[model samples]
Target chain A: MSVEPLNNELINNELIKYESIGISFGNRKVLSGFNLTVKKNQKILLRGKSGVGKTTLLKMLLGFTKPSEGTLYFRNRVIDSKTCWEARKEIAYVVQDTDLGEGKVKNLLGEIFSYRANKEKLDSEKLWTFMRELELEDNILEKNFQELSGGEKQRVGILIALLLNRNIYLLDEATSALDAKLKKKVADYFLAREDWTLLIVSHDKEWERDWMRIIDLETQSW
Target chain B: MPIYDISYTSLIFCFFLLIIPIFISRKIRLELEKSTLEAVFRMSIQLFFAGLFLNFIFNLNNGLLNLAWVGLMIFFASYTAIKSADLNVKKLFLPIIISIAFSNLVILLYVNKFVINLENLLDARYLIPIAGMLLGNALRGNVVGIGDFYNDIKRNENRYLYSLSIGAGRYEAVIPYLRKSLRAAIKPTLANIYSIGIVSLPGMMTGQILGGASPLIAIKYQITIMVAIYVSTLLSTTLSILTSFGTAFDDYGLVNKELYEKSS
Candidate 1:
């Protein structure tokens, strides 16, 4: 019947959508009238100048920042205070500055894994594999997180995202401190996963790929 | 033996001791002369009133009146704690007042009943001063605990949000900060416990000795009071932080920014 196709179309696969989004600090409008739609397994690299609200856009999905105007949707449901908490459980967010407080890296990771939703997610075998792939030595986990080099700290953020095993990734300048080779390796690692949805805000050119869809906020219509 | 009282002339001699500190402040350019004089003046006036008020309360010794005075102390203790912690006093006052009252009253009665074995349990001499000591210590603990907890979360907000994003419930994410703040709050009390007898004679023990009690009895009282102070401080600080959680954080688990007093 004709109704079957219509119902199939209505079963929307859009995982995240931002409609007419606007953000302002005081009188300055950092972002205005922006729109974006991300389908399942979509890889989006948001490109914009510094202070253009790319990070704010990513944080809006997690309810860290509220939009001054318009609506944001996750799985076709409006992302409010309640739904945002549920959305956070499914998204792995790697902040630009990874400050895990004053503690040994091992203990910090243990604390994260101890969360109810994150329980039993700490796979030591997978941790070692990711550490080796990220070029982090075994002894690095013993060092204080605050004392690690910028690149090491950034990788730690990335490592946490990987360890979370969530499908949706929000990377805000996550690889800025890494070298070119590691950047490409990290980019490739994330891009190779066809089932993962990535919303990346990075300035590195290594993330540019043939299959990736880039949204340049500077040039996009407001 | 009878307790000796300082005469008005002897108290004047006590006021004269300030001249030495005033001279030292002047020589060292510590700029404390005015504050030193003002502090001495204020202490004299405040203690003068407190002595008179306490004298009247002790003579009456009505159970209700003694409890009422303790209640007033708890109210002021809560007010000063929030104000000193640099939080919005109006927002935090209710929870803090309740917490201070609950923790101090429970410990105070427990000490009076079980330790001292007081039949009246509301004797002004035992109740008011013990309440003062417990409330005073708990007030300091709450200031350090509540202030550090909120400030730490605000300062390390990204780390907190990272935990939240990784599927941490609000309580789970805050547990780290809670552990840290509680430790900081109790550390001073712990240090005092360790250094109490050797480094200094605590005020209560000194008072008892001055009031013609044996050193042995004074030490016993000092030990008991120190233990009581430590336990009540921990209780109040923990309770203050836990009770304020509902108001201090929004529904999204983010700290309520308005609860923080704007830095002037």
Candidate 2:
């Protein structure tokens, strides 16, 4: 419960503003004249029907696509490609499909702490502890990644994001493949974290109960 | 006497021989007749034009004209390389051209200077056909190499991004794809070399023999050309793939979907 302050700080950040942002593909408009303002650590749930541009909004935020119009700010600072990379250090994104790399979970995990920027802060012990907490066995690290079940892959992806130590997490339907028990466990691990902020895109109402804000793509235009 | 002309009259008579296959195909209700006829016509037209051009090139025998002729071949080869490749042209054209030119030129010069020991390395009789052979084979290889590499990366975009996200540099991230595609592309050329005499009489060897050269000399030349083809194919494919990498990805090291012709 005390983690609520950290969530509030994230929600209060001045950079969390969206003005007139919109995107279109071919001739179809996904978003138009959309407006949003978010503060630090605020858990956000983005809900929409298929093809309503929920992914597009996230893509725009990640600099994968540019808005047809509108501006995005991060803590009151204008966000562009360069700033986005810098800000990305504070964000970890986990998509539903765990198709990130072509190696075992351990190899992928080893790569995170191997970066020059992260070299000074490698934490294998902490990662192993988290793996245990997530109910993953040490042997799971040795299994071939392509052979993992969807639930296992989802959990592994979360572990990767967690290892990155980013305060803000962008999760798109991350728990859809998980069983109920594991899903609840994941939800608690994230929502219960003291220093974390999450912007989650999901259709599962089960995972949204703890979210502080809900942005519906169906009702929000542009 | 000519060693083996397979004379004009015999060649003309050979057209009738197609009836054997056509008659058989008809019983099977296969519409192979039209396609066979189209293929025969295209082959005839192509060989006729190629003969005419070769005659002119040989007669002129000037180094500059021969080099220009080779340039035309490279241009055609590069065009096919880029087209067959799954890569986006806006990102791929320049590197491919450079690699094609570099590999072709280097082998062309080496073959001319060392193997044939011609007084003038660019002599038409020596340069034009050799460059054509080398560049032609390299083009086939580049198509596979360039095409396969990018397609592999695109197919495994998630894996690539995961590598980058986890702190692998761009080159390191893509090396796995590079190694796999390179092996696939080079395999055919390598197999051809290994099976040269046992499986098939290579075209250059057969041509030299028909032109009245001794079998020994023809075999030697065939061996040289095969080696040249191997070297140039490796050079061009690797160079082209590596050179194009910089343009194929965006600033974030993610492959730009726009660069590909359509999704691989």
Clashing pairs in 1: none
Model 2 lDDT per residue over B1-264, tens place: 367668778987899988987897799978898888889989989998999989988988888888888888888889888887756665787898889999999998988888888898878888888888998889998999988888888787666655554445567677778888888888999999999999999998888888988989999998899999999999999999899877887776677778775533
- Give the top-scoring candidate (lDDT): 1
Chain A alone, TM-score per model: 0.95, 0.87
Off by over 4 Å in 1: A1-12, B26-31
Error of 2 at A60 (Å): 1.9
- Per-candidate Cα lDDT values, in order, are 0.91, 0.79
CAPRI-style docking class of model 1 based on DockQ: high
Against the native complex, each candidate's DockQ, computed on alpha carbons, is 0.80, 0.25
Fraction of native Cα-Cα interface contacts (under 8 Å, chains A and B) also present in model 1: 0.78
What's the DockQ of model 1? Answer: 0.80
Q: lDDT tens string, model 2, A45-104?
A: 788888987767765555556788889877666678575665555567787887745577
Chain B alone, TM-score of each model?
Answer: 0.96, 0.94
Stretches > 4 Å off in candidate 2: A1-16, A48-50, A75-77, A88-90, A101-123, A204-211, A219-222, B86-91, B152-176, B210-220, B245-264
| Model 2 chain B poorest 10 in a row by lDDT | B161-170
